[model samples]
Target: HPQNPKPQNWTVALEKYYLSTMYSLEFIIGALGNIIVVFGYVFCLKKWKSGNIYLFNLSISDLLFLCTLPNLVNSYSKDQWAESTLCHSNRFLLHANLYSSVLFLMVISIDRYMLMKHPFRDHVLQKRNTAVVVSVAVWIGVILELLPLLYFLEPVTAANNYKCLDYASSGDPVTSLVYSMFLTVFGFLIPLLTMGCFYLKMVCFLQNRSEQIRSALTLEKPLTLVILTVVTFSLLFTPYHVMRNVRIASRIPALNISGGTQRVITTVYIITRPFAFLNSAINPVFYFLMGDHFREMLMAKTRQLLGRLTTTGK
Candidate 1:
């Protein structure tokens, strides 16, 4: 009777072990992969060009977000906040880094656009100092942008354990809607549109830059990067936003969205949270995977690591 009690304290058919394993893998892969990416961009390449600097900062952002994944994994598995302050700080870092990633990608596209439009002006703003200044500004912007999230996040007990939940309990409905709309729109859609338009124009310019010059450069790459970013951004974020509202709308009896639908949406949202994180995880791989220089550096590093391992074993 007790085993088949009237109300179960926890979820059934949750695949808790499997979910925990996946989260662990996600944390490990994200952490190690991003570290390698940072190493590749910095020490291995040894080139700090404008493009390189942008990519490095992008890598750093990914690395920072990845570092937060382990804490999240632990929280998910234990279903509680091991450290409240750490959790809030991680949320801020992750959110800031993700948004900053969008800005840097937009900047990269703009840089490409500038190069395609006026290659002669490259030296004017492509200097190392210029890259450093831009990187500093991007970081500052991220810090300011994420300052709000710090206040919203608070530790609360749910499912008999403490976890970080947003301050929606006190925040007004209108305020929440406005914030969500802006976050979903400006955070994802606008930068996407800007990148798309700029890249399309850049492609047109590249086509006109004479066959020899075009052939020497991998002109298709710019469009490829745009396509990857578009797919990952849309797939990772769109549903999360939709389900978040569904979760809210469920509380209002007048909303008329069925309870069953909302439950299904919430279940799916929980199941798919990890995939949404791939938006940050996959970009660096896409950016550098096929490039000759990137591959060379990666291979050399792999061999050195292997040789060191072999010597240590001896």
Candidate 2:
């Protein structure tokens, strides 16, 4: 990569080192958090409950996504894509994780709508193959959608003196801008809209039918707050994403980010991305484990583990 007239400040090796450290932490966080979600869902929540199916699917996606993080950590930490083809593929894996998470969230929201509004819907109430099929199909579609990144996102040398990521090495500046826009809108925005709309429908339906609220509110207060938090999260993520792409496109000197203020505009990329990924791990404790049945299952599992520890004399 040749240097543009305006240079980025960081050195490549130093930036790689910093990214390596951050990725190490990210891997650990994702591993432990998503594993907990996966284990709890599989061992305890596998039975068909009103919402557990959606949650279990979400956990599965997160778990599958987390499984690839070590390769990512290795990519930067080892300071070479020489480690394995796996390391080269880690960025695509992460992108697939993003898509998987979005797809599962949509499933959850649609499930919520059905269970709340049309409680007798066979798809919502009974054990069915559609959800499982849909989840698998969704991952397949996401992989295909992200296939181009695999072609373009080689371990390219960075102009910023780092092995950081960018879109295709060859294309119009506006091409990346368009891809980023698509990623933001389809990957983040539309699913978020789906979440918001269906959750709103669920809330309205619940509030209308005194029976559902009476049953749920009695058993779940802080539990209900989990959904509320998710709704709030969706609302907040949209603008951050739009600004992210706008700032990314503006990173091109030709886009004119405020006459030598490109750095500040581009800073949103660094600032907001961690917040988004961190959200994936944040919901486990409050959303699933804190629900009544789930809380009981978690405590039961915790006690069982402690008991095993005592028995093993470790």
Q: On residues 1-314, what C-alpha lDDT tens digit does candidate 1 reach at each position? A: 14533222233233244445655776676667778777776668876667677777887887787777777666656655666688678777767766788878777777665655555545666677887899899899778766765655655545334555433321344455556566667776787788888867866766676476755375566556666666667777667666555555554556676645655654665555556566566766754742436768878988999999999999
Off by over 4 Å in 1: 1-22, 118-123, 157-161, 166-173, 210-217, 249-258, 287-292, 301-314
- TM-score of candidate 1 on Cα atoms, chains taken together: 0.79
RMSD of each: 4.3, 4.2
Best by lDDT: 1
| Pairs in steric clash, model 2 | 11-161, 12-161, 12-162
Point out where model 2 deviates above 4 Å. Answer: 1-7, 10-22, 67-88, 118-126, 151-164, 168-171, 211-213, 216-232, 251-259, 286-292, 308-314
Highest TM-score scorer: 1
Q: For residues 30-94, what per-residue lDDT tens digits would candidate 2 score against the true structure?
A: 66876776777777665656456556666666666666656555755655444324534666666
Supply the global lDDT for candidate 2: 0.60
